[model samples]
Target: MSQTILITGGAGFIGSNFIPYFMTAHPDYKIVNLDKLTYAGNLDNLKEVENNPNYTFVKGDICDETLVNALFDKYDFTGVIHFAAESHVDNSITGPRPFINTNLLGTFNLLEAARTHWFDAPNTP
Candidate 1:
């Protein structure tokens, strides 16, 4: 059976590169890309997989728990590859809130969603 995977920050440089390669390697897997399209992310970078039937692009923030939870429920994602972050060092120093929110809280939201969807109980393997 094919699995659906959530790929965060997929329009960014590294995630964009990884998605196409991963798709080629795992053709049966469906990829849902969630990206906020921040300055570091570009949709054009992901054009290679834009037409692929198994590929989907969703423009949104990872910090939004409602959206993240909705996606988990809708897609029944089997896995998540997280790459979203506020990565500019200069910007992070000048304005740290976005970085903390996205890098820390955003990651927490994804993890929480995954845990809720994938596990039957807390700390159960």
Candidate 2:
């Protein structure tokens, strides 16, 4: 049986670097990558795994509860590698709403979806 996982902010610098490494390292696991494709995120960084059988890419925001819940229900993810965040200090100082939404609210949404799907409805097939 293969294990499925959700990886957020996968188009960003660090997450993009990790995705290929993780896929190569864990051939038995399937990765469902979720990224909002922010200015800091570049799809070119993930070109290596574009055709990998065990990899999937989704363009979406982490703050979207409906989308997050749908992904959880669809993938039955066993784990999450959350790397999404608004990391620019200057931008945060200038405009903090996006940072708060993506970092805080987005994390909450993901956690809630995971908890609901993995714990509250463990019997879902």
Candidate 3:
């Protein structure tokens, strides 16, 4: 059976490097890359696996709950590899809201979507 995985920030440095390796390592797994294409993320970084049948890229923000939930419903993701964040210390110091929104709320959205999708009764167990 093939597993579908949601990879947030796959256009970013670490994620862009990791996706290709993960795809090569797990051929049976499908990857759905969701990235907002922020300053830290670049599409050229993911050119390697862009054409792969098992790879998909979505240009969007992880902070959008509606989009995230819709993705969970549409893809029925079996797993998630979250890498999205605002990591520049200088930028954070200049403007912390983006960092907080992406790092905290974005993570929360992904976790909540996962929990709702994966559990029959999220509050149970």
The TM-score, computed over Cα atoms with residue i paired to residue i, of candidate 1 is 0.94
- lDDT tens digits, residue span 52-117, model 2: 989999999999999999999899899999999999979988899999999999999999998898
- Candidate 2 residues lying further than 4 Å off, grouped into runs, are 122-125
- RMSD values for the candidates in order, in angstroms, are 2.2, 1.6, 2.1
The predicted structure with the larger lDDT, 1 or 3, is: 1
Comparing 2 with 3 on TM-score, the higher-scoring candidate is 2
Residue 79 C-alpha lDDT in model 1: 94
For model 3, the stretches where C-alpha displacement exceeds 4 angstroms are: 121-125
Compose the digit string of candidate 1's lDDT tens values, residues 1-125.
77999999999989999999999999999999999999989999888899999999999999999999999989989899999999887888789999899999999999999888889545557
Worst 10 residues of 2 by lDDT: 116-125
Worst lDDT window (10 residues) for model 1?
116-125
Candidate 2 clashes between residue pairs 3 or more apart in a chain or in different chains:
none
Over 17-120, each residue of candidate 3 has an lDDT whose tens digit, in order, gives: 99999999998999999999988899998888999999999899999999999999888899999999888978888799998999999999999998888886
**lDDT (Cα, 0-100) at 59 in candidate 1:** 96
- Assess candidate 1 and give its lDDT: 0.94
**Residue 56 in candidate 1, Cα distance off native in Å:** 0.5
Whole-model lDDT values for every prediction:
0.94, 0.93, 0.92
